[model samples]
Target chain A: MSQFFFFLTAIIAVAGAIGVVTLRNPFYSVLSLVCHLFALAGLFLLLQAEFVAFAQVVVYAGAVMVLYVFVVGYVGGDDETVHPWDGPAQKGIAFVFAGMLFLELCLAILGSGLKALDTRGAGFVPGFGSPGDIGELLLTKFLFAFEAASVLLLVAAVGAVVLARRRGGIHDEEQRLSFTEFMRPIGTGTTAEGVGTRDAGINLPAPAAPAAPRSDRETLPTGGERP
Target chain B: MNWFVVVSAMIFCIGGAGVITRRSPLVTLLCLELMLNAGNLALIAFSRMWGNEEGQIFAIIVMVVAACEVTVGLGVIVAMYRRRLPIDVDDMRELHG
Candidate 1:
C-alpha cells in the first residue's frame, strides 16, 4: 500500500514537472509546478515524514504556487509575445548532462549496498516525526537556523517591497535616487524629501502639432498659371 | 525500496531534461520543479526503506524551498515580461552587458 502511494505520487510529480517545462504559456507552467509540488508533498507522506509533507503542501504547493500564479496572471496577459525555441545543440547538451547525472545516481544507488543497512531497529514509523516532534527539534537543536530563516524572510519581504515601489517620476524634484538614498533612515528627512523630487534639467520637450496645409491662393504659381 | 522509486526517478530525469532543453522560461521552471520533486520521491523511498525520519524531513524542506523559489521566480518572469513585452529567453539580452 505504501509503495503504491509512493509510486503514484512520484508519477504525478514527474508528469507535472514535465508539463511545466514543456508548456509555452507561463500561466499553465505555473499551474503544472503547483501540481508537481503537491505530488512531492504526498511522496514525503509516504516516507513517513507527515509533518514535512504537510509543510510541503502548505508552504510550497499552497501558498508559494498561488503567489506564482498571481504574478503570472497579473503580468503575462498577452501570449502573442512569448516565443519558444531550443537549438539542437543546446538540447543535445542538456540531454547529455541529464543522462550523465542519471547514470551517476544509478551508480551511487547500486554501489551503496543499501541491503546491508538493517531497518528493523531504526525506530522510525509512519508519522513518528510528527509536527510536535519537528517543532520541538526546531526550537531546540535548530533554533539558531530557524531564527536566521525568519530574519531572512523578513529581509526578503522588505527587499520585495523596495523593489516594487515606484519612485518619483520625471516631474519629481530628485528625478533619480541612488540605492543608498533609498535605504537611508526614514527620519533623516534629507533623503526623504528627495524621494519624489523631479529633475528640472531633464524636462521633456513639448510635442509638436501636425503642420497645416497652406491655402490654395498662397501656393506658388507655375509658369503656365502665371501666363 | 522497490521498483516504484526507480521508475519515478526515471520519470523525473526525463522531466528534468525536458525542462533544461526547452526554449521557454516557463517550461524550464516547470522542469526544474519536476527534478526537485523527483528528488523528494527518492528521499521518501529511502526513508521508508531505512525506517528513518530524516528523509521525510529533507523532502519537506525541499518542497518549502521549491515553493519559495517558484514564487520569486514567477515574480521575476512577470517583471521581465512587463519590461520586454515578450517571454522569449533568446531575445532577452538586457543583462548581457
Candidate 2:
C-alpha cells in the first residue's frame, strides 16, 4: 500500500518535470509545474514531514504558481508556441552535463552507506515535522533569518512594482486612438481579454480597427511589437 | 526514503538541463523552481533520517528565497518585454559588452 503511493508520486513528479521542460506552451509548462509540486508534496507527506508538505502546497503550488501564471500572461508570448530549444548543440551539451551530475549523485548516495542500510530511507523523527515544531524552530533558532526573509519579501515586492509599471508604453497609441475624432475606441485586441485566451494577457499592439494605417503603431520607437 | 532521494536527484538534473537549454525566461524560472523543490525534498528526507526538524526549517528558508527570486526575475523579464527587447536569451548579450 505504501509502495503504491510512493511510486505514483515519483512517477508523476518525473512526468511533470518532463512536461515542464518539453511542453511548447508556457501556460502548459506552468500547469505541469503545479502537478510536479503537488506530487512532491505527497512525497513529503509520505516522509511524514507534514508541515513542509503543507508549506509546499500553499507557498509553492499556490502563491508562486499564481505569480508565474500572471507573469506569463503579462509578458505575453507571441500568439504561437514558444519553441524552448535554443539549439540542438546547447540542449545536447546540457543533457550530457546533467547526466554526468545524476551519475555522480547516484555513486555518492550508493557509496555513502545508504545501500548498506537497505532501501529504507527515513529514520524515526518523532513529532519533528509538525507545524508547531517547525514554528518553534523558526522562532528560536531561525528567528533572525525569518525576520530577514520578511524584509526580503518587502523589498522584492517594491522592486517588482517599480519594474513592471507602465512608462510611455501602449498608453500613447491608445491615447491617439481615444483622441481621434473619426475613429471609435472599439475594445478588442489587448483589453478585455481573459486568461483562457490561452496563457493570455499578450495584448498585441495591433489596433482593433483594421483600416487604420498600422505603420504609426509599428513605428513606436522601442517596442518593435511582433507583427 | 533512499528511493525518494534518488528521485530528487533525478529531478534536480532534469531541472538543470531545462535551465541551461530553455529559451524562454519564464520556463527557465519554472525549471529553477523544480531544482529548488528537488533540494527541498532531499532535505526533508534527510530531516527524517536525522530525526530532527532542522532540515525542514532549512527547506522553509529556501522556499522564501525562491519566492523572492522568482518575483525579481519575473519583474525583470516583464520590464524587458515592456521595453520591446528581444525576449530570447541568446539575444540578451548586452551584458557582455
Candidate 3:
C-alpha cells in the first residue's frame, strides 16, 4: 500500500511539473504548480515528515500558490511558445544542459549508496516529526534561525509593498472611472491589449458623466438609484 | 528514499529546463518555484533518512525563503505590468546594463 501511494504521488508530481512547463496559459501553469505542490506534500507525508508536509500544503500550495494565481491574473496569460530570445538552438542547448545536469545528479545520488540511507541513521524517538516536536526544536535548537526568519519575512513584506508602490505616489487620490466598469469584455484576459487599454492613465471624455459635484462617487450603475 | 531522490532530481531538471526555455517572466518565476520545491523535497527525504529533525527544519526554512522570493518576484512582475513594460524576460534588457 505504501509503495502504491508513493508511486501515485510521484506520477502526479511529475505530470504536474510537465504541465507547468508546457501549458501556454500562465493561469494553467499556476494551477499545474498547485497540483505539483500538493503531490509533493503527499510525498512528504509518505516519507513521515508530517509537520513538513502540512507546512508544504499550507504555505507552498496554499499561500504561495494563491499569490501566483493572483499575479497570473493581473499579468494576463500572454505566454508565447517562442520569444525573440528563445531560438531553436537555444532550446536545444537548454534541454541538453538540463539532461546533462540530471545525469550528473543521478550519478551522484546513486553513487552515494542511497540504498544504505534507506535505513534510519538516527534511532527512533517518540513522536518524531510531529508539529509539537518541530515547534520545540524551533524554540530551542533553532531559535536564532526562527527569529531571523521572522525578521526576514517582515523585511520582505515591506520591500514588496515598496516595490509595488505607484510611481505617482501613494497619495494620488484620482480613481479611474473605467475601473468601475467591469461589464465590458476584457478580450479573453489573455491579451496584453485586454487590460492595458483600461488602466487609470487613459480617460474616455467622461462618458456622459454627470457634472454634479457629487457625481464622483456616483458610477454609471448608481445613477439609477440617485434620489 | 532512493526513489525520492531520483524524483526530486527529475523535477529539478524539469524546472531548470522550464526556467531556461520559458520567456514569460511569470512562467520563469513559476519554474523557479518548482526548482525550490524540488530542493525542499530532497531535504525532507534526507531528513527522513537521517531520522532527525534537522532536515525538516531546513525544509521549513526553505519554504520561508521560497515564500519571500515569490512575494518579491510577483511584486516586480506587477510593477512591470503597470509601467507598460514588456513582461518577457528577453525584453528586460534594461537590467543587463
Candidate 4:
C-alpha cells in the first residue's frame, strides 16, 4: 500500500515538474507548481517527516504560489510568446546533461546499497518529525538559527515592500479612493482635472452631461468611463 | 528507502534543466524552488535514515530561507515589470559591462 502511494505521489510530482517547465502560460505553470508541492508533501509524509510535510503544504503550496499568482496578475504579462520548444537544441542539450547527471546519481546510489544508509537501529520512534520535536529542537539546539530566521523573515517583508513601492506612488489621499472614484473623479466637488489637481485630491467637476458629445481623444483615454 | 534517494535526484536534475533552459525569470525562480525542495527531501530521507531530528530542523530552516528568497525575488520581478523590463533573462542588459 505504501509503495503504491509512493509511486502515485512520484508520478504526480514528476508530471507537475514537467508541466512547470513546458507550460506556456506562467499562470498554468504556477498551478502546476502547486500540484508538485502537494505531491512533494505526500512524499514527505511517506518519509515520516510530518512537520516538514505540513510546512511544505502551507508555505510552498499556499504562501509562495499565491505570491507567484499575485505577481502574474498584477504585472499582467504572464503569457510569454516563446514556444516551449522554441529552442529545441538548447533544451535537448540541457535534457541530455540532466539525464546524465541523474544516471550518474543512480549508479552511485545503487553501488552504495542499503549499507550506505546509516539506519539508527531497527525501531520506529513515535512522534518522529512531529511539530513538538521540531519545536523543541528549534528552541534549544537550533535556537540561534531559529531566531535568525525570524529576523530574516522580517527583513524580507520590509524589503519586498520597499522594492515594489512606486516612486511618488498613490498619495495618502489618493489611496483612500476606490478605483472608480480615483479614475473617473466625477464627484467630490473639486471641479478641476489634470496634473496638479488630480494629485491634490480635488474633486473634478462631473462632465456637463452624460450624453454630452466628446471627441475621440477624451473618450479614448478612459476607454469610455465606467459607472 | 533507496527509491527516495532516486526520486530526489531525478527531481533535482529536472529542476536544474528548467533553470538552465527556461528563459523566463519566473520559470527560473520556480525551478529554483524545485531544487530547494529536492534538497529538503533528501535531507529528510537522511534524517530518517540516521534517526536524527537535526535534518528535519535543517529542512525547516531551508524552507524559511526559501520563503525569504521568493518574497524578495517576486518583488524584484514586479519592480522590473513595472519598468517595462522584459521577463526574459537574456534581455536584461542592465548589468552588461
Judge candidate 4 against the unseen true structure and give its global Cα lDDT, from 0 to 1.
Answer: 0.81
Candidate 3 Cα deviation (angstroms), residue A120: 6.7
The residue pairs in collision within model 3 are none
Q: Which candidate gets the maximum TM-score versus the true structure? A: 3
Clashes in each model (backbone N, CA, C under 3 Å)? Answer: 7, 0, 0, 3
Name the runs in model 4 displaced over 4 angstroms.
A83-86, A113-122, A169-227
Candidate 3 at A17: error in angstroms? 0.9
**lDDT tens string, model 4, B10-61?**
9999999999888788888999998898899889888888778899999999
> What is the per-residue lDDT of model 2 for residues B1-97, given as tens digits with 9 covering 90 to 100?
6687899999999999999878788898999999999999888888777667889889998999999999999988888887788777766878631
- Per DockQ, the best of the predicted structures is 3
lDDT of 4 by residue, A1-227 (tens): 98899999999998998899888787888899999999999999988889999999998899889999988878774566565556778889999999999999888877876664644323457989899988999999999999999999999999999988775544543443443344454433343444345444333344434333243226435544333
Give the residue spans of candidate 1 off by over 4 A: A77-86, A116-121, A125-127, A168-227, B2-12, B43-64, B93-97
Report the TM-score for the A-chain of model 1: 0.68
Q: How close is candidate 1 to the true structure, as a TM-score?
A: 0.69
Model 4 lDDT at residue A23: 86
Rank order by TM-score, top first? 3, 4, 2, 1
Task: Provide DockQ values for all models, in the order shown.
Answer: 0.43, 0.58, 0.65, 0.58
Per-residue lDDT of candidate 1, residues B1-97 (tens digit):
5453565566577776876666556556666766776777777677767665566556655665665556556656755654554565666667741
Chain B vs. true chain B: TM-score per candidate:
0.86, 0.95, 0.95, 0.95
